[model samples]
Target chain A: MEWDWAFVMQILPTLFEGVKITILATLLGSIVAAALGLVIAILRRSKYRLISMPTGFIAEFIRGTPLLVQLYFIFYVLPDMGITLAPLVAGVIGLGLHYGTYAAEVYRAGIENVARGQWEAAKACNLTAFQTWTRVILPQALPPMIPALANYFIAMFKETPLLSAITVLELMNQARSIANFNYRYIEPITLVGAFFLAISLISVIGLRWLERRYGRIG
Target chain B: MININRLGGAVSAAVLSSLLFAIPAKAEDTLEKLKEQGFARIAIANEPPFTAVNPDGTVSGAGPDVARAVFKKLGVNDVVASISEYGAMIPGLQAGRHDAVTAGLFMKPERCNAVAYSEPILCDAEAFLVKKGNPQGFKSYADIAKDSSATIGAPGGGTEERLSLEAGVPRDRVIVVPDGQSGLKMLQDGRIDVYSLPVLSINDLVKKANDPNIEVVAPVVGAPVYCDGAAFRKNDTALRDAFDKELAAMKQSGEFAKIIEPYGFSAEAAMSTTREKLCSASN
Candidate 1:
């Protein structure tokens, strides 16, 4: 199919609006995922089985299911239960919660990678539990986890297209609407691919910088 | 490892060669190809009264009924139906995925540029499915746009969505619902303020839903009554012309009315306009 420069120019503004929402969803979702993952990782480490066992099971359940189905349930079914969420809110929550489970595993591994001597050393310094975690343990744990967490952030950005199924008016949805209206699939679909590639490439470059800066655990 | 790689290369080569051989040879005539195959694949949407799949998996609706009758007259013995969304049908036809689209896809100037269409077969006016008593006071697409908080659901890639956009409804407010059933469900659950479809299709859905809270507003203000025709790939004009000739004869002999009348469509309305007029008309 031939590319139409005029058609591409006409749709650029509308598509740019969608791109703003796409990036917004990813940024907000990444924040939620990073925060929720820490909470889940900390809770799962609890000595009480009442807290840790159920938390482990729930995280596994969410991780086991497809993200698209989860999105549908939140956007369509949750309203029936009187828990209606605005489209963007539902989309971000779905993305955050789904990726948060996977991120939790990374956090758990990072925390576990801290040598047992580090905790014992904190105790030798007469540090309280909070001081041990906040001062000695987490600073050492968090740096190495940055590369993996950045990878999931990139993945979550790619998965933002699935939000279109719930009518979030994201980039892919906007492209499909333009394609449907004009009866031309080539230009819009190609433009979406180009946009994704450009963003992902930039994210990769950023991820490499993060890895170089934070990869050393010492 | 080298042996395994060699085996993989050989297997892929065989598969690629077989795929090349599987391509169908071009037929000199479209009708000849259909007659030899004995069944023509037609695309339909599962929108009731217009096109639908029966419980036993048989396809029957006003659009397909008229299409089947006309194809039979043209010597195609059977019509096999595949349910598809309105937006995908034309591209499917162009890709040779289906022989024709009988999915009540309305004829528009943009669409006319893509495929050859037979004479108009099903005609209908726009309608909205709203909550009882019309809480939003939404009588039309323009009204939906006026209320910034309102969301309207319409089938993806259909005329209603286009009408809503043309009426100045923001892209975010016009939700592309998957089907008539989900549209009804969305309206019932307050996910969308209004569900848009043709009059007959809305009646069928609201009846099937049996929900007292929903009501239909027909002839949505400022939208024209749209007519649909069986669409074929642009290269299949000979087959389309033949089908149109038989369709015109059926309309003349009152046979067309008999087939579509039971489905609650007015044959006179369909016959009142020509494809030329609809295709060339300015919105």
Candidate 2:
């Protein structure tokens, strides 16, 4: 099939607009995932089974279900219950909740890797529990978690296409829209692939940089 | 600490396996693949009456029913359907996501540019669902455009949407939705003045909505003439040709009419016109 440069150029602005939505969703979703993951990791380590068990189960449940269903439930089902969210809001929340479960496992591993002696020493030095966690455990734990989080950031970028199901109009959705309206697939869809690959490659390089920088932190 | 190490290895292994299994099958000799697999991966529009997913996840519809019988006669047993929107069906087939599409999608020339479509399976007419009693007196697209308050709900990339746009309906006035469900929902919620689509599909949507306030705007303008056809990727010339042959045979054998009549379709009107004339003349 012949590539149409003019058509590709015409749809570029719209596709780029879609890319902006995707980037925003990924960034916002990552923030929610990181915060919720840290909370789940902390709760899982709590002394009380009441706190830890349910938290662990919640994380596992979210992890077990498909992201597509979760997205549908959030976007469609929630409106029936009198909770209406903008498509983009629903997308970010669904993405965040789904990935947060995975990140919790990462956080739990990182936190547990801190030597037991560090906690013992912190307590002996009259450090508060908050101080012990913030200064001692987290500082050591966060470095290892950074690379995994960066990987998740990359995964989320790729998954942004699925947001199209809810009419959020991301890059893939825009490609479909362009092709549908113009009756041409060679240009718009090809541009979507190129755009996704370019962003993914850049993210991979940035992730490698982060891994190196964080690995050297310890 | 012990659990930490174990979890890391398990997670890495799972991720690796997911990546390994993610490779999709390449479409080389698609007919052979279908013959070997015993099912053609068909793209379907997830619209009721035309096509809907059962509670058990099996697909059934007038379009799928006719297509299935035709394929069965061709010695294909399994008809695996990938649910997609009307606009996405063609691209999905071309992308190798599905071998063919039986979405009751109309045979239009612009679409013919992208994919090879089989003979007409059924003819569906364009119509709309408006607020009860036709509050705006918007019987047609022209009527809707004449009034400032009338917002027409157009399913994005579908035939009605393209037609509405061509009929001089302003883009700002045309509220484009992603699917039939959303379009119906928008009309039910009173967000749009008219939900435009084919008549049989509209009947299905109306039954599903079950709201007395919403009614079908009868005698839809712009000629009640359309033929739904099976769509295949342009590259699959052999498969499309075989399908056309089987389709013509089904039409002559009266199996096509038997399949469509049960789904609230006028099979006679759908099949009276042939593809050769329709394809050449339709915009």
Candidate 3:
């Protein structure tokens, strides 16, 4: 079918609502990934093998599996065990848990990039372990990791369409619904492509800005 | 972002070329092509009675059985079936992904306008698969819409979803369940208050599940009984008409009744309605 511009205009408002949910899922998922990754990284680095081994395996497991299957487990399987989450909550959890493992790797690299001398110097200064991590190592480690972590979040943003599997009304889902109803894919699907391209372009610019702000290792 | 730019460029190029090729196309050759190809591609929903896939991976059920017989009569050797969601069938036909959709994708004015539909094939009324008691007392789409907390699930892009929307349920409230089994799971999980589909499809799922916790409410209030036809691409009217001719003869010869009745579809219901009447009926 020919591209119907009018149909595009008509469906934009509905699609924009979907875009809002997509952005919300991405933003919330990014926050979860950032926090959870730090916890996993710290746990995996623990002196006790009991904690570290399981933590490492879990992270590996989460990273090793497909996000879509994980989403189905969270959305469908978990409910049978009496833990029912709303569609958005389950989607965000899936997105965060899957990406958090990758983020943990980034965390490990960033922390390792902090030289041993810095830790020894913090110990010599009589600073506590918390102080060493917070004041010295983190300040040094975090800046360079921003670009890598931001890259994951942007990647996560593109993958948000998978949320539709569990019935999150994200952009791709909304576009499909519109196309299904109208029996016209040319406009709705093309609009979805346009929306995704525009958003990714904008996010890439933001990533560049983030890189400029926190990119330097020194 | 560069990839996005490439995607945008590629989409535009594809759309432009399609437009260029839209006219001066070859004429009435789809049937000829299918006959030569040995099999007509047909879309089925995998929802039983209407359409189903067997354990051996062969396709059967009333819709495909009828379509297969019609194609065999049309001199095509076999019908190749693909399981598709109801919503994708029309677009799939348009995209040349399938020759015709034998899925119980009900005929509506919008769908009638979109595809070349053969005379109506399978007919059924809407039904809800709700909690054992149907505690919310939902007998109709309007009932679910009126209850603000109530959520209903239907197969994505299916007629039940459209009916729910038309009945004034908010978009967020009408969950697009992926399939019959999932819909039943969602119902048991209490993720959705009601799951809707054709009456027979729901019965088939409930019977398979043997779940006492669920019940079916058939002939949903104010929702008229609807029928589905094998949908061909808009430009494939010649193929549709040829298929229709075979189908009409089968109906006249009692073959159609024998093929469909064992699957629990009422042959008279389908035979009594005309596409013009269903398509022009006020929604």
Q: What TM-score, over all chains together, does every model reach?
A: 0.91, 0.74, 0.92
Q: What is candidate 3's DockQ?
A: 0.68
DockQ values, each candidate: 0.55, 0.24, 0.68
Best candidate (score: DockQ): 3
Per-residue lDDT of model 3, residues B59-136, tens digit only: 999999999999999999899998887888877777788898999988999888888899999999999999988899
The reply for model 3, stretches above 4 Å from the true place, is: A216-218, B1-27
| 1 against 3, candidate with superior DockQ | 3
Pairing residues by index, what is the TM-score of model 1? 0.91
* Best TM-score among the predictions, by candidate number: 3
Model 3 / residue A205 / CA error / Å: 2.2
Candidate 1 segments whose C-alpha is farther than 4 A from its true place: A123-126, A216-218, B1-28, B54-58, B252-255
Candidate ordering by TM-score (highest first):
3, 1, 2
Candidate 2 fraction of reference contacts recovered? 0.33
lDDT tens digits, residue span A146-206, model 2: 9888888789878888887776767777777777787677888788888889988998898
User: Model 1's DockQ?
Assistant: 0.55
Residue pairs of candidate 1 with colliding backbone atoms: none
